[model samples]
Target chain A: MPPFSRFTALTEQLPASVPFVGPEVQERQAGTPFMARLGANESGFGPAPSVIAAITEASATVWRYGDSESFDLCSALARRLDLPCEQIIVGEGIDSLLGLTVRLVVETGTPVVTSLGAYPTFNYHVTGYGGRLVTVPYRDDREDLEALRDAVLREDAPLVYLANPDNPMGSWHSADAVTAFARSLPDTTLLVLDEAYGEFAPDGVLPPVSDLAQLPNVLRYRTFSKAHGLAGLRVGYVFGTAETVARFHRVRNHFGVNRLGQVAARAALEDAHWLDHVRAQVAAALQRLAQIAEQNDLQPLPSATNFLAIDCGSAVRARSILEGLNAHRVFIRMPGVAPLDRCIRVSAGPASELDAFEKALPTVLAGLT
Target chain B: MPPFSRFTALTEQLPASVPFVGPEVQERQAGTPFMARLGANESGFGPAPSVIAAITEASATVWRYGDSESFDLCSALARRLDLPCEQIIVGEGIDSLLGLTVRLVVETGTPVVTSLGAYPTFNYHVTGYGGRLVTVPYRDDREDLEALRDAVLREDAPLVYLANPDNPMGSWHSADAVTAFARSLPDTTLLVLDEAYGEFAPDGVLPPVSDLAQLPNVLRYRTFSKAHGLAGLRVGYVFGTAETVARFHRVRNHFGVNRLGQVAARAALEDAHWLDHVRAQVAAALQRLAQIAEQNDLQPLPSATNFLAIDCGSAVRARSILEGLNAHRVFIRMPGVAPLDRCIRVSAGPASELDAFEKALPTVLAGLT
Candidate 1:
């Protein structure tokens, strides 16, 4: 049957494609579950016992809608981030927040700037809002700040996205460099500073909140999905100047965040010990993964995040290695663009999962030639 | 201190008002929790025990992102509804789905039709997307379907909304009447038939799946928030022709639904015995509420859903009664517009909450003059 014919012209022109086909879809297609799930950069170490306890406790109270204001969670986040509650706006997840952010600034044909192969979800939202995307390529496997600034000025883009301790490549810039880049942007441009992996980065890798707190043009986003291991719960927040963040109140899904997510996130925030434990475990796993890469005669790119990007020499070789590992029922991902696609990205997980990857790599690589 | 100056013109013109200020906000302002929660129409009977078990069981697996496609939940809903999986789209909630539907059909100055004050959340989304709403006043306290269709034709509107077993009034029209209304609208005017209270409504009040299944312009929205008592989990869905539902895939946040919500919803759908039990309890509670209204010399409207609307003679009297009940820590709501505001709305809950409401009504009525 013909579809509803009244959708907006913009909707008609948009492609019905998603940013990523989830691993579960792959498992269903292959008719088998992967032995090792190392894609998506999820913390398979799992949420803290305290967080799990909180979720279980909150399960019975699931009849009441979550706080539309998310008052308590925001109050708790404010104390931790040293920002006033008015400067924070919580939503379903960073992806949802990114969509709202784009909707606030973009109209048809409005220019948006970002790294070419950076977070596809961000790009998806930009296009979904009918914004014109202006992309800059990465330099030395890192988001090139100078090129991004140049593109923003050239295109007069209203928005730009940057993820620190970057995705797919697992690289990062020092706090000084990031702050300098933010200061260099025009006031008319809003920078979406994504720090989803900030918890796993080294101490000096993330800029102090106060460093950019004075700028209305900068909004920093963080999530419980990464370090806290609550990806499935869907809670993320963005903080900026109080005046700037209040704009989100104009368009956000007020009751979007789930009740158990609020409970789990608040408990996760209070558990410093578990966070430290996950950090140490991730560090050790990254080290082990580097060794495995070296043993296979591959170069492991340095990462300040919980994943390693091992260069497989060429894009074709990387593709073959990825397919071979998939044949062995091990799930992992590679970047989408040229130079970056030469490496395979693996998230830090439990030892057993890593052991599965370790066992599968040799046979896969041996068959690659 | 200024908000970022680069937000779009539409964003600037939009007000920062929310649809409903949650009861939690009121409790915070009152400096105490309510003795009873009869507002927001939440199920105080809570989710089924089996559903809670499912949530607790799934809590540990939250480290993994929920399946972006919502394959299992959609598959289960398809089986229960006897529709193809491709015809359904699961989302964060009906509120979120409403927003997406408006986005797909609306642009600046686009005309949309609905009853005045029918559902503020739907109005909020229409205005957020810059749609011009053409409203028809309710006739005799029920949605004036003939007037709504007239407005759609008059405005050449692309969208219209109707909530069955309506909120704030607890009144309904027969399935045949609703089907006739849907058939009268032009194919270009998509109908958002909200069935949030469908589970609580009397059986013959809802249209059978096959009644309007062939109309690409009609979509039905249902939720677990009411009869299934999973409001805090944020799971709602829309079903239409397979071709029409595919448009949501172009713009929806792929991973928006939470993992525990999907698990709880699946379990709730399967627990037919529990649903029947909840429906029986709600029937009893509604009877008790009607009696309580009569004891206070008020008129209780006939209801097919799980709430009672009692007329207090005038808007001023209704406002006074609502304030008095609030002072007694018994939370309830009133309609927003003129003739409808003459009544107060109370949701059916557990017996203890009903007892609190029953006790408070006499004192509130005595002070109303």
Candidate 2:
């Protein structure tokens, strides 16, 4: 029999496809696990021992639902960030939170502005909500902030997304530039400022909380999945003006954040020393990765994020290298669009994984030559 | 200054209210923890030792994102249910799945049918999507199946919701009657068959998998939160025809299900002996609760779920008893609407928790009288 006949027109038009293919799916098809798991920008240095301990301790109480308000975790984050708890909203992750943000603003034919090849999941959400995407292409391996601003005005878009220390290309804008860009948007246009890589960026790169905390039209998103190494737990938060953040309560899944995630995230926040340790490890790994790239005659881009995007000179070479890496059981990803597609993105991990990547890259490039 | 000026009209119309106030919030308000948690229908018997072991074992790998496909858990569920993996969709919980279903089918002013005091979270999702709700009042403490069918036909609703072995009033319909009710709906009207409590119900009370598996309009949702006792992990699933289930992929948060939740749920499913133990405990707890109600001169309603809904003879009396119990540090809940509001609901827990409830009941009842 055919499927139910009365799905919304928007739902009917949506393609049955996921944003990114998970490494596990690739493993299943390849009949083996990847030797070096550096894809998808996950932190392989692992969460703090305290966070893991918290999760283990909390497992016995798995029968009780999490606090619907996420009060304890929110309070902990508020204390750490020096923001009022009312200004923060915790969610399953930045991905689910992005979907919620899209749902709240986008209706059929609503124009949403975003950079081309920035984050496919954000584009997926906009299209799922029937929002017409207005794309601004990257200029010089960076999210072209000026072009994005121009498109928002041209399309009169209510929503615009910008990820600083951006994905696929590990480029970043100065804190002053980002602040000026956010200030430029009209009051009617809400800027979804994704700072997923904020923790890894240098001091001058990220805007202070006080700089954008009071902006009603800006929502800053951050995640524990990156530097804190809790991607598997799926915990993230968005903070904005209290009045604006209140809207999430209207439509959020009240008990969506799991109990263990809440516990793990709170513990992660308290462990400042562990975060510093991961940062040092990531920095060293990135240096090693750059040396490997230089040794293989590839250009490594300057990075503010945990991952480095190496220039393979051409899209064809990049594609060939990605495929060859897969064949060697080295899982890595690359940009989806052109120009930027000339680079392959690799995340920082332990020395052993980097050794695997180093051993595989020379052979892959040789094969390509 | 003010909030962002351009949230969608549906979002503006939505009130910033959650479906249920969690017991944790109340404990904070009261500045003390409840002595016994018998509300929210959470299984206090805890997850199986095997499930906890799985969560603990998997906690060390918290850096990796869960498989977006949820292949392992889905495969396990398929083997157990004798349904193809293509027919299953795993989500954070039934709440998240319900929201996705509403988003798929309901648009602005789209007619949707459900019982008056059924799952408020489902209604929240419908309203969040701007669906017009057509409520059928419960008949004889159960969902009025015929009345629901009439309303669906009359309003041409694209969606209808029913929770068999229902919530708020722990009553259920026979499997044959439920099958007839599902078959009665028009092909255009999709039925959200919530079976969160299915594991606790007697064998014949739930429709056999084959009876409704092929019906494109009927989707069955079950959870690990109830009988399997993993509410805090936030795992649930929906199964139907392959084509219908495939629609979830279009909008689902690809990595929303956490890694440990997947592992824990799979372990819970494999431990059949633990589930049987929980069932036997629930049966005994329900009997004990009924006896306590009878001793307090209240009428205990027949229940097919893990909770008992005792009729307090009037809504005012029920409300008074609930307040009095709160004063005694017992956490329980009641229905939100009339007739059903004449009862107070209590979940089955361990003997120590039941002892706390037993000690508090008579005094609260005497004060109410």
Candidate 3:
């Protein structure tokens, strides 16, 4: 039978593809679970014990829908961030928030600027809304701020996405540089400053929340998925000026945030000691990953995030090494675009998972040779 | 300062209002919790113990993202419904699915049809996407199927929404009538047949899953929220022809479903005994609600779902009774539009909650007199 003939022209034009191929899909195809799940940048340390307790307690009340306004969680976040609740909007995840943000600004043929190998989910949302993507290439594995600004100006783009303590490459810029870049962007161009890895970065890497909170054109996105260890809970939030963040309510799925996710994230925020402990563990794991890479004759790039990008000299070698690691039951990822594709990205995990990666690396490298 | 200047024209036109005000928001305003929680149609009996156990067990793995494809849950749903997995797409909730469905079909100024007082979320989504809603009024407290067909034909709408065993009024249409209505619509007009209350409905109320599964334009949306008692988990699925269902992947948040929600939903779906137990309880509660309404000199509408609509003779009396019930800490709701607004809607919950409503009713009615 013919499909529904009336889907929007934009939806009809969209390709039947997803932003990321999930690890579970890969596992199903391979017929075995990866021994070391070092891809996707999920926290291996897991949520704090208090968070687990909160989730367990919340399980009994699963019949009650989550507070559509996300009152308590937003209140807690407001207190922690020194912002008003009106300026914060909690959503299912960064991906959901990105989709909503895209819907707000994008229309057919609207220009959106981003680094060529930036977050695929952001790009997916842009294209899903029929926004014309204008790509900027990475300079030395870091998103080229000047070129991204130039594209925004050249194309009169209304949206731009930048991830700090960048993914896939694990590189970062100084706080001054990021602030300067934000100041340089046209006020009409909304800057989606994604700080998904902010918790793991050094003190100077992230500007104070207050620094950009006044910018109406900026929305900073963060999540518990990375350092706080609740990727499965799917809670994320964006903070901006009250006028800008309040607009999300007009378009968002009001009850989309899960109840246990709110409970777990609130508890996770209160457990500062757990975060510190995980930070230490992540630092140690990053060291172990670097050592593993060096021992196997690969270059480990300096990182401000909880992952290392090991340069394998060329994109072809990186691809082969990634496949070889996968065959040995180690799951790792790489940048999708060239230049940065010369590296394999491995998330920092517990010592045991790192041990699997460490053990498999030499064998995979030797096989590739 | 001003808001971001470049939000799409449709977004600027949308009012910053939500479809439903949650009970939590009400509690915050009243500075006290409601003794009886029945407003949102959530199951007060809660999810099965086995589902809670599954949730607690899955809490430990909250660091890993949920299976993006929702593979196992979709597989189980497909097996239960006798449909192919390719025909199913799981999302955060029915609300999210409805939003995505609207995005797929409704462009700016596109015409959509629905009963005037049906699911407001569906209407919200249509308007959020700039669709012009063409509403048919309820006939004798049920969605006027014949009129709805006429409106669809009149508007040549590309989308229409119908809730069987409907919300707010607790009314339903026979399966044969519903099937005939589906057949009457233009094949180009996609029907969103929401069966959120399907479980509480009688055997003949729902058409066989296979009957509509073969239709390319008929999408059936179901959820774990109503009878399965997992509202806080925010899990819902839609099934249709494989070609039609595949369109959601291009626009959906692939990782939006939380991990424990999937685990909890899978367990809830498997707990048939718990569902049967809840059904019996709901039937008894409905009878009790009818007795309470009759005692208060109000008319109880016959219901096939988990809630009843108690007619108070006029919209003013219904409004007064609803406010009175709220003042007495009995959380019940009334339909938003006229004709339907002559009744106050109350969900069937545990007897204790119903007792609070029964105790409050006489005083509320006396105050109205």
Q: What would the per-residue lDDT of candidate 2 be over residues B80-143, giving only the tens digit for each residue?
A: 8899999999999999999999999999999999999999999999999999999999999999
Candidate 1 wrongly placed segments (more than 4 Å): none
Is 2 or 3 the stronger prediction by lDDT?
A: 2
CA lDDT of each prediction against the hidden true structure: 0.93, 0.94, 0.93
TM-score of 1: 0.99
- Which candidate leads the pack in lDDT? 2
* Best model per DockQ: 1
Question: Tens digits of per-residue lDDT for model 1 on A1-369?
Answer: 999998999999999978988999999999999999998899999999999999999899999999998889999999999989999999999999999999999999999999988999999999999999999999999999999999999998989999998997999999999999999999999999999999999988899999999999999999999999999999999999999999999999988889999999999999999999999999999999999999999999999988999999999999899899888998999999987999999899999999999999999988876
Order the numbered candidates by DockQ, best leading.
1, 3, 2
Q: Please write out the lDDT profile of model 1 over residues B265-367, one tens digit for every residue.
A: 9999999999999999999999999999998899999888878889999999999999999999999999999889999999999999999999998987777
Model 1 chain A lDDT-worst window of ten: A360-369
TM-score of 3: 0.99
Q: Give lDDT tens digits, candidate 3, residues B193-306.
A: 999999999988999988888889899999999999999989999999999999999888999999998999999989999999999999999999999999888999999899
Compose the digit string of candidate 3's lDDT tens values, residues A151-205.
Answer: 9999999999999989878999888899999999999999999999999899888
In model 3 chain B, the worst 10-residue window by lDDT is B208-217
